[model samples]
Target: MYRYDEFDRRFVNGRVEEFRDQVQRRLAGELTEDEFRPLRLMNGVYLQLHAYMLRVAIPYGTLSSAKLRGLAHIARRYDKGYGHFTTRQNIQFNWIRLEDVPDILDDLAKVELHAIQTSGNCIRNVSADHFASAARDELADPRVYAEILRQWSSLHPEFTYLPRKFKIAVSGSTHDRAAIQVHDIGLQIVENAAGERGFTVYVGGGLGRTPMVAKKVREFLPESELLSYCEAILRVYNQFGRRDNKYKARVKILLHEAGLDEVRRQVEEEYEDIKSRDALTLPHDEIDAIAAYFAPPAFETLPERSETLERAKVVDTALADFVARNLAPHRSPGYGIVTVSLKSVGSVPGDATAEQMEAIADLAERYSFDELRVSHEQNLVLPHVRLDDVPALFAELQKAGVATGNAGLITDSICCPGLDYCSLANARSIPLAQRISERFADLSRQHEIGDLKIKISGCINACGHHHVAHIGILGVDRKGEEFYQITLGGSGDETCSIGSIVGRGFSSDDIVDAIETVVNTYIAQRSSPEEPFLAFFRRVGEAPFKEALYGAAPAAA
Candidate 1:
């Protein structure tokens, strides 16, 4: 993890002081809400339906134990006793007071964390795969580039007010774990034919009302020119992107209207002029220095397989299931990556209580390497745990109620804090998510159904990324009634695609049954459980599922 240098500490402290003054002005009636809206947003403070919310950045989702403790302290001392981890790899404290925000930020700065650029989004937090440095299939650590982008984009005057909020994601592996294809800018780190590392750049991908998979704009952009190329793309969007209507202000909308070829041409034209600037051209030493901070941890030589872990699994079936679901392959020999699932049985999807946070922080520091990662899936990761420690870690996690072996299962749903808290939401999402989770609470049933992703959104804002889930649900309000729309065949991996809606919407009372019907249809239509829900949907299209959900097979044409 990157520690704050003198410059970083100074910058954060200065911003804290500035926000403190702004908050005082607003409270004292010297500034009105209209005048303070942008300022508050710039500081990641939002006045939601129930209370003020503060979104703190977790740069690339990497955190030291100290930082995790600091967040837990904030959750306990400042607002409610829990915090919500978002799909964007950030955390939002939902019940913050407007007056205490500066103090909260000061506390965050004590641990080298801040909420700056987390909202109103100059470029937002640069996210990456949670398995960045530890994944067995990683091409490079995406955090190196993510951190670089974070530094370059932080408070950039030129991009401070773009056409709309911008987001960028970087992936260091062939798999799109970071959902890069749904970002304003997506960078896939790869090696060229000549063995030189570079990026396959994609632009204009997003998932609001106008969901889209980003189009590749460059086949191979040298690593040295990453910042320059990103700047070029942003310049094109800023110059030609829609601004008259906030609804169509995203880069995805601009690309949809103007066409990818034209957008590429504009970016290339811009790149030609700015590519050689000293500020944009990254030197080998600078790149290496940043990468050095994210180097893999030292490992002890040991047998690849742990006999003790194997014995523990053989004796305990639940332990075996958890080992299978929660553990991911690590690049280091005799090591594994553990996901601490936040989607426990019936609790909120992405929430972690103060005690839970403290427990996780202790686990990471003790078993993993004093470091942890917040996954975009709303899970925490111990990226370098020894295989021998797996059993002990699983036991500790189970005791904490944070260990539900439902990773990538139906119960492991991605949900937003819906109408319950968000002013922008049209309907309640958490209750529906809780309902579905409870319906699929059976361990055997969840394992029988096999790898399925359910994503729910309260509205079209798509904060929960409903567009790319295998089973996507959207909550809409019609005449003050909550109606749910279901989408199928969407995925956010190497083969990313936006899902298509099945048919008419269902009432809240009827939605769970509708989802169950789809699952049953999938089971019947699939070749086997091995064929997974997504593959089955793709193999047969949505007709069978639609027929099952709505009614019997349609009458002969």
Candidate 2:
């Protein structure tokens, strides 16, 4: 929701013009593929398996109706009729023409959006809880800080090309919906003993071939020191992070090699050096200005009208389910945050057609404050919808095929594009997700199971965030055959830990059945319906599910 200032506007326009020329030069044979690769990557263009893919940054997953419409325009005109919203709170078009990328960036810039920092080995888009400013229990709006970081990191001379890609996430609430623990830098908004707002910064967390929860580098950094402290962490990483091998290039690997104490010492030293520089430390006025950009729009003062809401609840069971599952607590009295589930049964988890995007844009403009947010789970959020209008909104969303009565339910899965669109994948993830979703098509059964996170990654990169899911499924190739491996007891919250791998892998034919067996085992062993699958699993361990998947045969063990 932060409007582009004059300087920001000029910078993006200039970059678009520069990329346009670069595209022309590449087409004219003035530059080789290798020579032009970095330039194109800087503009968020990638040469994928079948075509060029353009990734557009949705900073902190925040967007206005105008910006959403711009994305829909790109999807309709430049590439296919649909675009994929990624787990990083970005959107990707898989079938872009190389020559059209500059045009796309130009169009995005017009809407105060850009593709900068969406790709390459630089600080990527900063993500936060989609319901940031609107959340009832929010300590502070993380996007206000995320936007500041986005501007500071954009085309930053020193961090333009790090050893590998870096990601950052922030959460202002106790529940870590943004999965902060698995990012390269995780900032949790906290209060000090004096009751002033600050950040608890974590560093070196990532999921790839190696998955590790970030270590706490700073206990409580003042609001004014956020930028400088982050810069300190990046400076240390850029200076000492491994560049010897691609596999060893990430800051996480560097942290692993150097140990947390050394990394912490280096960052602290760097922070001390940069802390006094005015260029690094944001002024109080500037911080207030940034915070003002996210101030909630005026809402008509009204009491909670349970009479109207209860009438709809009495008549419509589906609406009641949606009201319970889709609505989130809001800071405003009569308003609530709503997540419009794109994971309708038998549909791709994150793919939104141009029409759906337009519809969502319209809904945001009409019912909310023209504000939309792309969630880390690949869904959209209208963060300021009124509770009294829930019935009408539900009807519109249901007509658009974006309504599904599962938010934290078992079937509401998080998945990667996987082997279908990603060249890096070893096996297919979408089909696997589809199979699992179909297996739990019975809404009552899914509700009975309750609050299970099924995250699937195509390969070891963990793009699907498999390591953070309560039920993590990883797809790997064994002797040219696709097999799926299961990991249990993982979480991405205040209590973060990498999942431990279960005994063995399951064949593609057996994965759905294996997941069913795991669920059924939880159902049979659970003490009560209130016990979630994760709680039950944590209490009983993986022994029951392991036995169910691989029978009593000694080889199964």
Show pairs that collide, candidate 2: none
> What do the candidate models score in CA lDDT, each in turn?
0.92, 0.88
- Candidate 2 per-residue lDDT, tens place, 94-176, comes to 99999888888888998988888888899999999988988877898999899888888888899998999999999999878
lDDT by residue (1-557, candidate 1, tens digit) is 78888999999999999999999999999999999999999999999998999999999999999999999999999978999999999999999999999999999999999999888948999999999989888999999999999999999988999878999999999887999999999999999999999999999899989999999999999999999999999899888888899889999998999999999999998898896456689999999999889877778897888998999999988889998899988887799999899998778999999999999999998999999999888889999999999989988998788878888999999999999999999889999999999999999999899999999999999998899999999999989999989989999998999998988888999999999988888887789768988888878897897678766663331
What would the TM-scores of all predictions be?
0.98, 0.97
Top lDDT model? 1
